[model samples]
Target chain A: MARVQLENVTKRYDDVTAVEDVSMEIEDGEFVTFVGPSGCGKSTTMETVAGLTKPTEGRVYIGDDDVTTLAPKDRGVAMVFQNIALFPHMDVYDNISFGLRLRTFSDDEIRKRVEQAAEIVQLEGMLDRMPDEMSGGQRQRVAIARAIVRNPDVFLMDEPLANLDAKLRVHMRTELQRLHRELETTIIYVTHDQAEAMTMSDRIAILDGGELQQIAPPLTCYNEPTNRFVAGFIGSPSMNFLEGELIEGGLRTENFDVELDPGAVPGVGVGDDVTLGVRPEDVHLAEHADSLADHTAHIEARTDVLEPMGDEVFVYLLLAEEVQGSMEEDPASSPNQLLMSVTPDTEIHEDQAVDVVLDRSKVHLFETATGDALVHGLTDRSDQESGPTATEAE
Target chain B: MSDRHRTDGGETRTDVLTESHEAELDRGPFQRWVDDSIKNPQKVYRAMFYVAAIFFLVTTLFPFYWLLMVALTPEGQLQDIIFTPNGFNPGAFVEVFQTIPFHWYVFNSFVIATASTIVVLIIGSLAGYAFGRLEFPGKVPLLLLVLVISFFPPAAFFIPLNDLFNTSFFFLEPITGDGTLYNTPGAMVLPLSAIFMPLAIFILTTFYSQIPEGLEDAARVEGTTRLGALFRVIIPLSAPGVATAGVLTFIAVYNEFFFSFLMTDGQPESWAPLLEGIIAYQGQYEVLYHLMAAASIIGVIPVAILVIVAQEKIVSGLTAGALKE
Candidate 1:
């Protein structure tokens, strides 16, 4: 296994820049995922690393060797496609050994390797079965087997589990983690799902509009995002934000004013425009907030909608009456209108009036003009809870 | 077309979704096709569909029915009774063979059509794959050129093709007769393949383009070049399309008459496709209806057999992309 590094990699298609100045390092034996929305150039970056698409600028390295202009086959990487790209005409045996046969390996050697790969994917007794005859999950395994048989220095998988059913997707996620542990190969997976990235990768590189937003451990990006985009993108149901102007003691909005730690967000005085962000889990009921954290804001809110998600309920609270004036009005500007996540045991109902507080230690402050975060949270901030470890989650 | 191609490829895939559910795929064709979504199809709609289908089928098959009836009926009964079971005469079939070298014409047609079909398939699939997958400059224009070629009427090029074959009366002065294709199988085979190449390319290109692009990318990552990926993955998966192209090209080349008539000296002693042989029944003033009908029936046998053999492939090929996306 070799470390894969892309230095200032940029790819352009005529006038459109698909990927711009993307530089990242994937440590050997590390499972790093590239997570982004569509057209964010995450896949283009991976394609550049795979040598499938030539980078308009920059260099690619595997281990200590520069392989910038190498063909995909020569780059020592195997890719599992977004769609399990198994040859429908070929049986599992032929599909797995395609690369081996292409390299002109001996029949005995090919057979031995194919068997070994089939064992790795647990595809025994399936060698003679055509792709059409297999299930979606089995087809995916065959696709994986095709990649692993090559035993390349790096494995590139482009949303490989996206096509599987939800339950199967989760099952395969754990299987992939197990495979990564067993094989100890450098794997760079690209996906649009934040859950997959947080659960599977040692680190995740978040991209947007063809540019890298933040690249760090999943927990680090979750706890402390570099910019507004990262803060908004990294969490489920997304981190809620309330736009307001900075006042003498705190952030001032149309309705309630949230108390802020002045020292926490430095270089910002009264009348300065700012955005306040708090995670759903951080917005607790006033009584619960008092017990959990010290120094919080008390806001009178009407529960608009409550979504029960098994263990916890997502409660959408409207802090300002005018904010719900019309659906056409800017929804983002609805002051103090926050989505709070509470345990299922917590008594909450729709249209119920309740006093909720934003946990003082969990508030993130960003400059309104620039979407850059000036303050991540209160003190001794550790956001590891949001990013569950691979094993703990599975 | 690309938007249609963009549908989730996995949706069309019948690969195992679950053990018990997909196991049903191995049970029987009728059961598999009658999946839960379509198990209780609307009766009214199904009936209407069958009615429309039968109507079209009858309209398409009427000509062949008429040809068979005319060929089987005795020439003496042509004006009165169209068909009579016991009165059916096999004499015209033998008379047609005696009237013109029918077997030799059949043999000639097979040779020329087979040659043209083979050439079209090779050139068509190659060019089709290139146009479908490769990103080269002027690719759109080149594809448009192929489409334009397919649209050109055979009659529009008849005179020009005759001049090229040196068969026009003006070229028969014997001093400037340089066209080598005249009075040869090459004359018919070459033009037939050229005209059919566009259609073959169109069919093959569309089929190739429908395969998930990732398959080729996977091949490249799996240590094969683009060319290798095409031969090893794409082409093999497009069997239906190849069969479709082959059958269509064979039929088109087999039925071609204008170019064959213009290029070949139709004495049956000279090279002639079956169509040219059929025309021999029409002398200067009178038309041999019985002989022509018999010849027509004989000419249709090979094509009919080909269609029957490859009917499944043709149907699948035509409808594969229809439901997608």
Candidate 2:
């Protein structure tokens, strides 16, 4: 196992910068996933790390060796492509043993290692089957087997589960986690699915527009995201953003008001426009006559749609006044929609108005113009006191 | 009770039968005839199919039939106009060997053609793989050069190549040292190889390019060098394409006339090309029709067998990657 580090690695394709100044360190035996939408350079970063594509600038290191100039085969890293990429002409056993044979191992040694890999992947019975004879999941297992037989320092997989059906993908996800634990090798996997990243990665690295957004442990990233993008991207039914102004005592909306802690905003005095973000699960619903004093913000919106998932219900809501404006404008471009996840026992009906409470502790505030998160002022002051002095920092 | 039941039962039964008969008549004789035709249309189709098959067979095989008939006829009976053969004899086959050094020419032609075919397959596949996969300086320009050479007429290069082969120029000696290639098979073989090399390279290159890039990447990750992957993975996968190139090259070399005719004129005694004697021996005094026909038939057998054996490979190689699974 090896620690892989990218030192300000950049890749440029003519005028387009496919990966721009990506720098991250993967610890030895750590499972780090690079997650992003399509064309976000996550795959490009993985390819750069695998030494398949040479960076236009900067360097890559595996352990203490600089591998930027080395050929891919000499880099001592194994990559499983999204398509599995098994040699169609070779059987499963031969495919697994290919790298060992290339290294000029003895026939007996090659056979032993290949069988060990096959047993690990549970593919012993399929040793003589061609890739076409195998199902999608089996083909993926062969790909994993191929990588495992090499016993490389690092394993790089690019969206390896994207081609499988949903049920098979879940099964393989757990199997991969088990494999990672058993092998304890450094694995750098790339996927666009956030759920997969959240479930499988020890630490998740999010990327967008060729820039690294955040890299942290899964729960840390979920609870305390670095910015609006992270906060919105990490959660399912994504966090809802409501436009409001920071008034004298609380955030103000058209029909409702939110009370913020006095020390929440330090730099700004009043009348600062900020976008408030609250996750779907964090929003609590109450009956119209109930007292919502402890809750910071309260809004009454008519339920537009109800999706009954097994554990929770997703209630899509819209303000009555906002609905009138949306109807006047284009019916499709409305922005007043909100999705709230409530307990399965809660009763909600379409077109019925209900009071929703936003929890202040879980809410995130961002600047309207820059989209930068506004951390609570009390925590920032405490952190500043404990932080390094200028000369010591330098 | 029996009298009452008999009163209207017979009349009702007759009325129902009459109604069914009237409905069948209304459907018309044409409809009935169409139904019968649909049930047994294969008979008419089979008859027409047989007739077409017979026409195609006669058209295709008549030339070969005439060639065999001429080959078996006596030289003295060449002028006979009757369709029926007076007698059969193998005198022409023996006479063909007696008049010329036929065995020597056969040996020369076989050596030249087989050697050229092997050379083309090896060099062509290597060049094709390089052109298809490798990234080096002037690659695109070199590819364009190959395409240009493939389209250029072989006759255009004859004079320059002849001069190069016949005489010492610049720093190098003539190709065969003291003896020029003017009356040797090398003159024909070398030039013909150069002419067909581009075709071999083009076909194999196109086939190699259709293989997925992921397979090569997998090979690279498996610790195989680029060249090793090419030999062990890419070449084996492209067997059909290589076979196609070999077959086409063999056919072209086997049938080449102008180069063999021009180069081996002075030494007709050494010319073993299958069709060479047919033209060379067609003089005013002795036409030698029987011997020419027999030689032509013998020459066609190897090529026909090769084409039949390699037909499947050719089709698959040409159609690879054109359709999705």
Candidate 3:
């Protein structure tokens, strides 16, 4: 297994910079996902590491060797694509043995390895069946078997489970994790689905506008995002933002005035414009405010929408809509009203008036103009007052 | 729709069948048929489809029947040829094999059509792969130019081609150093391959493009070079397109009469394609219509057999795109 490093990697196509100065270090045998929206350079960064695309600048290192100029075949890496690209003319056995045959392995070794890979993917007794004779999941297993037989140092999967049906995608996601654990090979996966990234990765590197936004564990990125974007992107239903100007107490927007103890947060905050960020799960209803008593800020609001998600309910609370309408409207301010998430059993309904509490220990504050997190650990939830671990906040 | 009287599981099975029968009895015979048609339109559609198909089939096969009737008629009895043949003279087809070294011309057509078809498939697939997959400086304009050339009338190139064959270097000419490639089987093969290449390339490029772009990339990442991936994956997947191109090129080359007639200099003994040889039956003094019809029928037998053998290859069951399901 090999550790991969990209130092100041940048890729450009004509005038457009697809990947801009992305530098990440992935430990050996670790599963790291480069997750982002489409066109966010996650695939481009993976391609650069795979030697499919040369970086316009900087170097790519795999196990201490420079692979920036080498062909993809010489990199000792195997890739699985979103569309399971099994050879249509070849049967399962032939497809799996393709890499071994290409490397010119002996007949005995090829057969042994093919059987081993088939057993790993649970594809026994189907070796002689052509690709068209099998189901979609079976074809993808052959694709995985093809990669498995190669026994490469690193595996690069670009949305390998994107084409599967929803139920099958989840099943294969768990299967991939188990495979990685058993094989102990370094895997660099790229996906646009944040949920997959969060569930399957040891560490996730979130990208936006061709820039690496944050690189941390999924929970770390979720609880403490480095900036406004990471906070909103990492969590389900996304984190909510209450935009306002920083004042003597805390952040003062059109309708709500959140009070913050001065000694609780470092750096001068008066007259500095800021935005209050909190996740949907952190918002508490009045009946559920028992655990949020310490420094919670309570606000009375009218519920506008209720989305029942079986396990939990997303209640969109409208607070001071007439007051928010008085200011020159901003797009980020559209979510100015809070979206409080509660357990499905909670007695919440649309158009119901209730008092919602913002968990003071779970609140985040960011610069209004720059979208950078200005004050992390403002509430000292861990009681260490350590602030965010490093410059990345998480 | 109710199963309230059901007690045991075995009785439930019989009750379900009886209920379906009662449901069927609820509608009139025509209404039941219409309801079945609504549920599955394919069976009804096939009935009307075969009727139309048979009508067109008869319109096409009637000419072959007329050819057989005239070929069996007695010599020069023009009036009775269509109405009645002299007898079931099965020996008349032997004249087509005897006249003007017909076997040699048949062999020439076979060699030229088969060789030209092989050459066309090779050149077409290579060019098709490049056109469909690769990015080059002037790919679009070059493909457009090939398409435009395919539209050009074949007869329009006779003058320049005839001069180029008879007057250019020996590379263009035969080894005899006469600078004339006339009446050589290789002469017809070259022009036929050139004439049929554009359509073959078009068909193949379309087929290759429909395949997902991920196959090559996946192969490359799995440790195969681009060209290696093409041979191992892409070319094998393009078998249907190759067969289509080969069959079409073979048929067009087989039926070619203009250039085949032009280069042979009217000497059927030295050089003639099947089409030109059929035309040779009309002599300078009197036209032998009966012999010509007999030769025409014999000439198509080889290609008809080719169709029967290659018919299944034209239907593709490729599964590359199904991986995304």
Q: Which candidate comes out best when scored by DockQ?
A: 2
- For residues A123-196, what per-residue lDDT tens digits would candidate 3 score against the true structure? 99999998889877888888888987888989999998888899999999999999999999999999989999
Which 10-residue window in model 2 chain B sums to the lowest lDDT? B316-325
Q: In candidate 3, which residue pairs get closer than 3 Å at backbone N, Cα or C atoms, i.e. clash?
A: none
Given candidate 1, what's the lDDT at residue A296?
61
Residue lDDT tens for model 1, A1-394: 9999989999999899999998888899999999999999999999998989999999999999999998898988999998788876668898999999888789999999999999998999999997877888999999999999989999999999998999999999999999999999999999999999999999999999889998899999998988778898899888888888976555677677765534346677778888888888988898776577454657898898888999889988888765563466433335657888999999888888899987767778888788898887653322323223223323
Error of 1 at A42 (Å): 2.3
The TM-score of predicted model 2 comes to 0.83
Candidate that beats the other on TM-score, 1 or 2, i.e. the better one: 2
In candidate 1, what are the lDDT values of residues B1-325, reduced to their tens digit?
4455347666434333554585755656666556633765686468779999999998988777777777777665676534442257778889988876789989888988999999999899789889888889999999999899889987787777777776545544464354356776777887889999999999999988877788888888888888787777787778788898899999988887778777778856567778888888888977877678889998889999989988977666455422221
Mark the 10 consecutive residues where model 2 chain A has the least summed lDDT: A385-394
Assess the local accuracy of residue A220 in candidate 2 as a C-alpha lDDT between 0 and 100: 79
Off by over 4 Å in 2: A253-256, A261-273, A287-294, A320-335, A376-394, B1-57, B80-86, B90-107, B118-148, B169-175, B179-186, B265-272, B277-284, B312-325
Q: Is candidate 1 or candidate 3 better by TM-score?
A: 3
Of the candidates numbered 1 and 3, which has the greater DockQ value? 3
Tens digit of per-residue lDDT, candidate 3, span B95-177: 87877677777888898899999899888988998998887889999999999999999889888888766664666534645
User: What's the ranking of the predictions by DockQ, best on top?
Assistant: 2, 3, 1
State which docking tier applies to candidate 2.
acceptable
lDDT of 2 at A356: 85
RMSD of 2: 6.9
* Model 2 DockQ, alpha carbons vs. true complex: 0.41
